[model samples]
Target: MDVLAVEVLRIPMAVDLAAIVIGALTGGLLAAREGFAVSGVLLLAVSGGLGGGLIRDVLLDVPVVALTNPVYLPTVGITAMVTFFFSGWLSRTTGLLVGLDALTLGFFTVIGAQKAQLAGLPVTSVVFIGVATAVGGAVIRDVLLAQRADIVQPGPYNAVAALIGASLLAVLAGPLELPLLPVAAVVIALTAGLRLVSVLRGWSAPVAID
Candidate 1:
């Protein structure tokens, strides 16, 4: 039987949307800690939630999911408000924010890769879009917060993890013709796990040599 004889591994669109909400929650928490007002919180949250996918859609020449999906806007908006109000409790949890951030990184990387592939993009473009989408929101968030983007800073393996995940997608789902859901799950686990370990252990990606 052909690959189509079995059901493919596409994750439901609704489940994938949790990634945007998680990103927005992180942004809202950051805004709260920064003493940003309601407007500022909303701005950062929206940027973090939708920025990466916006870039992906624009580059792919597709409709922006944030604008097109009714649930996207409202869900992210509510996530920001919740994070803004309950930031104290959220922060008190052990590594909760960082975990969520890493999780979103994994989700974005795989999602971007899958979307690009569905668009008939090249492997290189798929990886690029995947990595860009994973880190784009954090770049925007840090810029708005007046700090250097963490991905650019000599910090943990944020982009590196995304790179690994995207490349894995290129290999496993693209050429190998494996099930996308399992491939996506593996990508998310490795990407997020690598990120979490790097953060917890203070493992820095190699910096530019002098």
Candidate 2:
């Protein structure tokens, strides 16, 4: 492994584990709202939680973490359990679920950029991969559920937040040589903050009505 690769590997696996939990929670909440059974919740949880990482690894030409890491499976499993236990409370709040989804998007976007940089991909490629990583899972979830994806529709700055977060990661990686955790933190905070603010302020990209 190269220096960047080694550095990236040194990043605590717990971060990705945490993201998996968050993704599962979001997925479970969505499934419950959609009147899915326990099996459906598990399916969505696994799909949503690991989907981004799987896509990222494939794009980077590496083994998918879902296949290689035992940690990934249990994390989603635990998340499903928690969601199952707390389904009553979580199912009542759609906004909270949306917030978690936005957070997942931010974290995954940063992770994608970091991985791409570690793989020595170009900055532009890293950005594209980051956006895909952030939104890919939700796209899959939506397609599976047969609903319009939030990233594709006008809801908030979902994709924009991912793009900005990825751009920040790419710029920071190139110059500051920041550690993965700090870089991820900054990117996630910025992206999630922008998303929350957009939600609160009704900020959105203007579309020209043809």
Best by lDDT: 1
- Ten contiguous residues minimizing lDDT sum, candidate 1: 1-10
CA lDDT of every candidate? 0.85, 0.81
Q: List the candidate 1 regions with Cα displacement exceeding 4 Å.
A: 1-9
Tell me the tens digit of each residue's lDDT in model 2 across 13-56: 77667777888788877787778999988888887898887888
- In terms of lDDT, model 1 sits at 0.85
Candidate 1, 1-210: lDDT as tens digits? 133212313666666677888888888888988899999889889888998888888888877877977888898889888987898897786477788888889999988888888777888888999998898888888888888888887889999999989999988888898988889999999999999999999999998889
- Segments in model 2 whose C-alpha atoms lie over 4 Å from true places: 1-5, 92-100, 175-182, 208-210
TM-score each candidate: 0.91, 0.87
Best by TM-score: 1
